[model samples]
Target: MSDPWLMPDGKTKVDPFVEECRLDEIPFPVWFAPYTKGERLGDMLWTGGSGLKIASQRMIDALQDAKITGYRTFDVDVRDHAGNPIKGYVGFATDPGPTTDIQNILGQDGQNFVFIANQRVVEALRAHGADELDIRPYDPSEFD
Candidate 1:
């Protein structure tokens, strides 16, 4: 059978980095962040739910134009507290730094508000001032 995450056309539906990073290599981090209603509203106004989509499309276009392959956008889920269901999207690549924009809007450190389970990604995020995280060992069964 085809890979579960692949599209019908045999293309990957998620980020290609998910595979390159060996995200399934047992105990990789899945990041999370919860936003307030106001924050959500502001994001909507800023991107109209198209920021990542547009960026991804543009990246794809550029890659196609250059005849390059294997590049993809980073995927992140903005979910509710339970992390059961994804409620929105946040592009890891497009996220503003903690000191510049997002943190100012959050009125606190963005890292303090973000959640991540992957140690490697967490370290990267923390290095950028997104130090506040809920780091935990990866549990695949929890997804089910």
Candidate 2:
């Protein structure tokens, strides 16, 4: 049986990843706050889409560079007053491996925003900010 939400035309469910992988996809309000500078696995929000074009452009350019690997994007839920994720936004991070040009993006903001890289990405994201980090995984069946 197929899910009712599935399209009547039998269109397969598309993964959110398909959108982020696009070369032209640009996210907004992306932040680069401070992160724990050490050996640890973590994630970061490359874009929050809060009307900040500069921040978003920096992240996009970095990601576009061929040097970045393990680049993946996920739909992080940042809710507003009504409890809805702000539109035109998404979060991204690379695997726990060093790469080039990452510093350019991180260093660009300086103290204006924390340079959230690797280990520090999660903490910096969850820290005092309008964009909340919804990195925690959810399994609907587990709740059911």
Question: Using Cα atoms with residue i matched to residue i, what is each candidate's TM-score against the true structure?
Answer: 0.24, 0.26
Task: Give the alpha carbon lDDT tens digit for every residue of 45-123 in model 2.
Answer: 3223221111232333345443343344554444343444444444443322255322223333211122224433334
Backbone clashes, candidate 1: 3
Which candidate number maximizes TM-score? Answer: 2
Q: Which candidate number has the best lDDT? A: 1
Once superposed on the true structure, which residue ranges of model 2 sit more than 4 Å away at CA? 1-58, 65-71, 103-144
After aligning candidate 1 to the native by TM-score, how far in Å is the CA of 81 from where it should be?
A: 1.7
Q: Candidate 1: RMSD over Cα atoms? A: 15.7
